[model samples]
Target: MPAADLTRAALSAARVWLVGGGKMGGALLTGWLDHGVAPDNVTVIDPGLDQGPHGVRLAADPAAPLAEGPAPDVLLLAVKPQVMDSVLPAYRALGGGPTVVLSVAAGRLIAGFETAFGPGTPVVRSIPNTPAAVHRGMTVACANGHVTDTARATCEALLGAVGDIAWVTDEALIDAVTAVSGSGPAYVFWLTECMTQAGIDGGLPADLAARIARATVCGAGALMDASPEDPATLRRNVTSPNGTTAAALEVLMQESGGLGPLMSRAVAAATQRSQDLAG
Candidate 1:
């Protein structure tokens, strides 16, 4: 079998325990099912979620019964960072050995899981954005020393089901990654909002402004994804020497008080916040 097929087959056979079934968790569940993971082999635990997809077991809480079955092959943590501390203890018993713990919670570190689940636990700390709901997300992951190659593949397969995946040896880089792709979708959404408002201020109808702004952002993102050329090249391709795009680019590309420096500052702030949360 091809490697991708083999990975999906392995994922299908693995018992996956999804610890939170909110938006991100739900997205991952959909991805997993689409990638051939058996619904019967997956379990979702969330007090807020009254029901889950058909054939998948759902639990209101991590009751004693949850620990009754064979240890899960993969324990995916998708809870918010604010509540992860309290949630981690409840599932501590599920860690270690064959069961790799994959976390999507922003700013939660592998050491925290290792400490909560035991030092021997294999923990993969990852940052994924909301775009995963549409299978266009970008995720960056770093694994602890205990994660075996096989366990890493399982984690990779699960993440790949949603979107693109990249691995890094330096866990510190994850904070930067979190600042970039993890929080990038929000920036794009804000850009759309700004464009919409700008159009309205420039005399366009409110509804039309919103429609065009939304379409432009979405379409540009799609174009970038489908293009072989780098973003800079694609950008330059549309910018005539003295045209409208160039006029805008002159301001945005300015060394001081420009989009580039502003974006750098924003990313730096986010990176710092990520580091703070990890503490």
Candidate 2:
């Protein structure tokens, strides 16, 4: 078997301990199970969580003795950034060993995890969007120096179960990644809202406008995903030289007062906020 296949097989049989059974965590758990990771090999630790998927053990406290068994191969942290500091200490015993700590919390830096888990611990900090619930999200991640090639492959396989994954050697790029892919889904939703409102104003009924707007946005995204052509090429293929799209493009493609500048400002603001949160 190929090395990649062997790594995947290992991950499929690997023991996983998921911290925080929130939206993202649940999504990841579902994805992993779907990708062939045994449900019996996974444990979810969340105080507020009532239950987990069938065959998956649930623990309310990370520090408490586990009726399940020993430490996991991968300890994935999905808690909110606000509660991460308080929650991290409980899992300190699970770290700095064979376990690789993969975190999906925004604004939490790799350095902080190293400080909490010790310098030799392998840590992967990632930012993933909400779309992972449906398994179409984009995730960008970075790892500390302790992570080995095998550990990186394991992280990639786990992350790949949800959606696409990208890595950055320089961890600082994660702030920008958070701004673009992390917050980008909200921007797309807002665009759908704007399109719906505009359609309503242009004589369509509110419900009709909303439905069409939502469908158009989703359809366009699907096309972008399926097409071999670049987005610019696909966009140009739809737009005529002197047509409705061109007319709209005239306003939107303006040098200064256009979507380009507006989106740049938005991304910049989000990037700054990400940095501030990390601090």
Candidate 3:
């Protein structure tokens, strides 16, 4: 089916049972509610939920009866990776249905879900960043072979509730996703921090420098997102003959090895570590 049709199907029929009410889960819940998903359709099961917005049902334990009705159409596992085993049993009754099981826990794989649930259970694993808390998250998801087209569409819809979604057939690539977008936000924040320090060194006021650094990066990212042109083209448009930006680019793109190679190494290291964790 077309991606658009899939999206529509998802929005029309998605009934989500979110297991964690932490930052990512709360962000997704907010996005869904904001996007017209009936709060009555969402059942959040989180022991730590001290407070929740109106319309959605919150439960401190999974054994509690759902206020909406029966089991959810989709079960979203958002709890921490370490506590997944403890949380799985509570939602196992839903595993027998046509429901799609979706997880945003880093390093958890499809096999792990199958073990916790039952064989042939449809599963979609994703790596989402904290930016998801603000409805700007980038999610990379992959479904187990047991997942059908409808199941995949359902998973996509649940993920789209938060932000952008990308599908991958190869589960191994999920590790790379973990390294890139999953951890990518931290890299951006680090850049902001370094830029602020540079401004400080350049003798700008501390507060002004911090604001400038943040606004520059945020604006640059928004521009990149809005533009049809490639990032390299956009970057070149900002550079001029012997200009300060060019000088900085020259150092950043040095021939021997520069930020590009250094970042590549960092991503590779992170990817390997994700694989290790999954193992």
Best by TM-score: 1
lDDT of each: 0.90, 0.89, 0.85
User: Which candidate order results from sorting by lDDT in descending order?
Assistant: 1, 2, 3
Point out the higher-scoring one by TM-score: 1 or 3.
1
Native RMSD of candidate 3 (Å)? 2.1
Model 3 agreement with the true structure over 198-263: per-residue lDDT tens digits:
999999999999999999999999999999999999999999989999999998897668889889
Tens-digit lDDT string for candidate 2 (40-71):
88888998988778999888887553443587
Ranking by TM-score: 1, 2, 3
* Candidate 1 local lDDT, 79-182, one digit each (tens): 99999988988887776667899999998988888989986889999998889998877999999999998888888989988999999999999999999999
* Top candidate when judged by lDDT against the true structure: 1
Model with the higher lDDT, candidate 1 or 3: 1
**Per-candidate clash tally:** 0, 0, 0
- Go through the candidates in order and give the C-alpha RMSD of each one to the true structure: 1.1, 1.5, 2.1
Of the two candidates 2 and 3, the one with more favorable TM-score, higher being better, is 2
